[model samples]
Target chain A: MQVNKSDLLRRLKKIEGQVRGVQKMIEEDRYCMDILVQLAAIKSATHNIGLAILEGHTKRCVSNAIRSGDGEQAINEMMEVLRSFVK
Target chain B: MQVNKSDLLRRLKKIEGQVRGVQKMIEEDRYCMDILVQLAAIKSATHNIGLAILEGHTKRCVSNAIRSGDGEQAINEMMEVLRSFVK
Candidate 1:
């Protein structure tokens, strides 16, 4: 979690623009397959953001928790969030 | 877009299990990079679910809106959701 918060937000903002672009493409009657391609790219970008967050969490929260002997609780909380994300 | 809802839910449930497994690996003090690799897998799984939803929305909602001459508004609504997802 020692990463620059603003950097992460900036990356998210870029993805926001891409999402808007995809919406516009859909509205403009773009080809179905083309739209799916754009959606795939957006999904990949989203996964990158998620990966960044996971890296931060593992490096900071998980490491700290393990050192403090609270790793189980921390992992449980992470599992909860992950389950929610998948849902 | 015509995909079975139950199938999607089933896939998500499996991903939920994978997420929990990753958490368990973390609690056992697995290597940092190994945890990141597991996280990467989870993120990819999540992206797959997102792709399915996006496909459904485009084929059903967007296509219907286009035929009904409400495509612009529908796209705007979709943009809102995309914004939230990136956030």
Candidate 2:
């Protein structure tokens, strides 16, 4: 599946900013709780990006594979990937 | 608890590089699966950062709070933050 380039780039840039924010927070000797909170935000942002990518893949790649009657292997591969996705 | 400055900065720098790598991949129109995998790596790295900060907070702040006899609320707060950590 093709990536939504602009949406991805925009989201990634936001994540980049968030990561830098955490770095600055650390440099400033911010509270540990604050840093943890920021890290959680980054984690979730990345997770959402993964979900977006997965959505595209499912809507395109997986669907095509199924239409081609190669559905089982494609579905299995996707499930394996999804298994890795759980924290 | 104080953050381990050098360690965190180093890790964040690596993460910064990873984020940039993802941006480059997007620009090059890389495969969706590859980008998704990279995002997973970023998610794990951020999760580790959170774990490190949580470790320091638990070892120092939580311990101190307990020793000072305010253990309950401190532990409760930490648990609340942890609840958010799960994907």
lDDT of each: 0.61, 0.86
Clashing pairs in 1: none
lDDT of 1 by residue, A1-87 (tens): 224555655654655565556555545556544555555565566566556666678788888999999999988877766665444
What does the lDDT come to for candidate 2?
0.86
TM-score for chain A, candidates 1 onward in order: 0.82, 0.89
Per-residue lDDT of A87 in model 1: 47
Mind giving the per-residue lDDT tens digits that candidate 1 earns over B5-79? 556546555655655555455456555445555556655665665666666777888889999999999787776
lDDT of 2 by residue, B1-87 (tens): 234778989899999889989999989978777787788889888898899889988999999999999999999999888888864
Name the lDDT value of residue A19 in candidate 1: 51
Task: Enumerate the candidates' DockQ scores in order.
Answer: 0.07, 0.73
> lDDT (0-100) at residue A27 of candidate 1?
51
DockQ computed for model 2 against the true two-chain complex using alpha carbons: 0.73
lDDT (Cα, tens digit) per residue for candidate 2, span A48-75: 8889888988998899999999999988
Task: State iRMS for model 1.
Answer: 10.7
